[model samples]
Target: MKTLWIKLLLWGYAVFSMAPLLVMLLSSFRPTADIFDDPLGLPTGPDLGNYAKAWTEASFSTYVVNSLIVVVSAVLLGAAVSLLAAYPLGRRRFAGRGLFAAYFISGMTLPAHLGVLPLFYLLESLGLIDSLLGLILVYAAGSIPFNVFVLTAFFRQLPYELDEAASLDGAGPLATFWHVMLPLVRPAIATVIVFQFVPLWNDFFYPLVLMRDESKLTLPVGLTHFFGEFQNDWGTLFAGLVMTTIPLVVLFVLATRQIVAGLTAGMNR
Candidate 1:
């Protein structure tokens, strides 16, 4: 009886979570009229036309390219900078070490909005305001704090014997990090990549504020253009949403094992 209730609960939760996606998928196929008539029913047959229209008519291809640029650049830069910065903080003892760590860690606690106005001015002076590079820089900076914190903890947990052994072998600090440490932290690196990249890909606010050219708009910002002042095109809007989720879903599926292993390593250790 307990097992039966547990299964029932699991099934119920699954349905609750998936029901909306199922409805959206089905709705994408049905004639808009059919949607008004019976939203819950499966498509009479696959319309597939909605996807093509959403892909071409909505200019999603360009949006996809822009989003990829922002996400990939941000994640790569964020991970590299955080890893380098965290290493010294985690491994070395030095004067003002606490203050330096606090400076980096403080960014995690402060609300981003507080910096937005100043950032806007700074970017404007640098003439970076409408550029993809500007967005990449902002995204990378915003993600650095938490990534640094995570990497710092992970680095601290690593055996210092490795560093000492490498030093005795006449390896420089850079050589030790490159040859000895980084290879072992691939799992943590994968975790940071997924965590940072997903948000950077999905972000809408920065693009809404920074991207002025429609051609330069990322997926989330471009999707908004599909909705006009007087009318809402539910079919295409949902199709755009579906398109946005595909890349993220694919990324999650491919990296699920790596992400799970890294997270679980913390528990098992």
Candidate 2:
């Protein structure tokens, strides 16, 4: 009886969580009048025109491209740099290594928004404001501490014998890292990618503050254009939202196993 009650509770929670998403999905297929008339009702038929309007009329294609470029570049660059930093901190015992590790980890505690004033001025001086490059740099730098923290744990869990074996095979440090160590951390890399990609893709604050050009605005910022002072385009806005959400859904579905593996990599150790 207890087990059955628990199962029932879980199913109820799942339905509660999924209800909004189902409403959004169904509303994307509806017209503005239909959505306002029956917000929770199903669409009479699938209206492909909402997607077309969102893609073309709303300039989501450009926003999507900008988001992809910024998020992908930041994630890859941050991962590479963090991997190099983490390996040494995790596996080596050099002078001041503990201090360096602490310094990197300290970033996790400091909120990025707290430094907005200094960062804004710094970017202005560098003439990087309103630029995709600026956004990429900010995101990449922001992600480093967390990436290093997680990857360091994974690296520490790895056996030292692997490094010794690589050295015996005449593999230099760089070669060993690239060929052997890197491959072993593939799960962690995917985990970082998924984790970093979602926030960067959805981030509206930085893009809204930094980007002045409509053509350069990311999807999150661009979606606000759907709202008017007196009214909102609920149907088309839902369509745009669906498009924004699809990528995240697909990514989680594909990388779920790898993400789990990465998170649990060092638990038994």
Candidate 3:
């Protein structure tokens, strides 16, 4: 009876969570009048026309490309920087290493609003305002602390003998990191990528704050163009939302198992 109840609870929660997504998916196929007439009704069929209308009318082609560029560049460069920074703390017992680790971890706790003023001023001075490269740098900064923490914790679980073996093979610290430690931390890397990429791809805050140009806007902010103060295009808007959600849905569907394993792999260590 208890096992049955647990399964029932899981299934119940799953339906509750999925109901909104199902509604949105069904509504994306609907004409605007159908949505107003029967908002919760099953879609008559897949309306491929809505997607084309949203993509071409809303300039999503440009927004999608912009989001992809920012997400890829920030994640790759941020991963490289975080890995290098994690090495000393993961493998060594140098002075103040605990304090140093704490410092990096503290970045996670710091309120984003506090730094916004200084960051904006600095970027302004550097003439990076309204620039995608500027947004990439900001996203990378936000990602590093958690990424470093995860990578370092994962690295610490490795056998110290690996470091010794590499040292024995004429590997210096950089060579050791590049050839030995990094290759072993692949799961953690994937975990970080999945976690970090999702938010950066969907980020609206920094892009809204730093960018004033429409051509430079990422998808999250760009989606606002479909709304007006008095009226909203319900059909096109839903279509746009469905399009925005597809990449993330596909990403998780493909990698959900890997993400779960990577996240839980070092818990026992």
Candidate 4:
């Protein structure tokens, strides 16, 4: 009876969690009037027009392109840099190593918003304001501390024998990291990529502040175009949301195993 009750509770929680996503998916096929009339009800028929309007009229195509460029570049760049920074801190004993690791990890305690004014001035001075490159740089820099913290842990957990073996095989430091150590940490890298991708894709504040051109705006900021002073287009907005959400879902599904492995890696060690 206790097992059955626990199963029932788990199933209930799952349903509760999925309800909002189901509503969003169903509403994406509906008109705004129908959504207002029955917010929880099923769509009478799939309207397909909402997606068409959102894609063509709302310029989601452009937003998606910009988001892809910025987020992907930021994730890759941040992960590479974090890996480099983490390796020595994790594997090598050097002067000020602990202090350096603490310095990188310290960034996690400070919120990015607190430094906005200084960051804005710095970017402006570099003439990078309102550019995709500027946003990419910001995202990459912001993600580094967290990525370094995680990757450092993963690197530390790796067996030192692998490094010795690589060295025995006539590999240099760079070659050993790239060829051997890097491959072993693929799961951690995937975890970092997925974690960074979601936030960078959904971030609104930075893009709104930094980007001046409509064409350069990311999906999260551009989605606000669906709102009007007097009214809002709920259907198209939900459609846009569905489009925005799908990539995240697909990515999570694909990387779920890697994420699990990465998170559990140090536990057994």
On residues 51-137, what C-alpha lDDT tens digit does candidate 3 reach at each position?
A: 788788778878888888888899988998998889889998899999989999999998776899899999999999999999889
Between prediction 1 and prediction 3, the one with superior TM-score is 3
- Superposed model 4: Cα runs more than 4 Å off: 1-3, 229-232
Tens digits of lDDT, candidate 4, 1-269:
99999999999999999889888899889998988888888888878998998888888889988999999999999999999999998888899999999999999999999999999999999999999999999999999999999999988988999989989999999998999889999999999999999999899999999999998999888877645411467788888889999989999999999999988887765
TM-score: which is higher, 1 or 4? 4
lDDT of 3 at 230: 12
Error of 4 at 225 (Å): 1.9
User: Which regions in candidate 3 have their CA more than 4 angstroms from the true location?
Assistant: 229-232
lDDT string for model 1 (76-183, tens) is 999999999988988888999899889989998999867888999999999999999999999999999989888888788788999999999999999988998888
Lowest lDDT block of 10, candidate 3: 225-234
CA lDDT, every model vs. true structure: 0.84, 0.90, 0.86, 0.91
| Candidate 2 structure quality by residue, lDDT tens digits, 135-184 | 99999999999999989988888899998999999998889889988999
Which 10 consecutive positions of candidate 2 have the poorest summed lDDT? 223-232
Q: Which 10 consecutive positions of candidate 4 have the poorest summed lDDT?
A: 223-232
| Winner by lDDT | 4
Winner on TM-score between 1 and 2 is 2
lDDT for model 2:
0.90
- Please report how far candidate 3 places residue 61 from its true position, in Å: 1.9
Q: What is the TM-score of each candidate against the true structure?
A: 0.90, 0.94, 0.91, 0.93
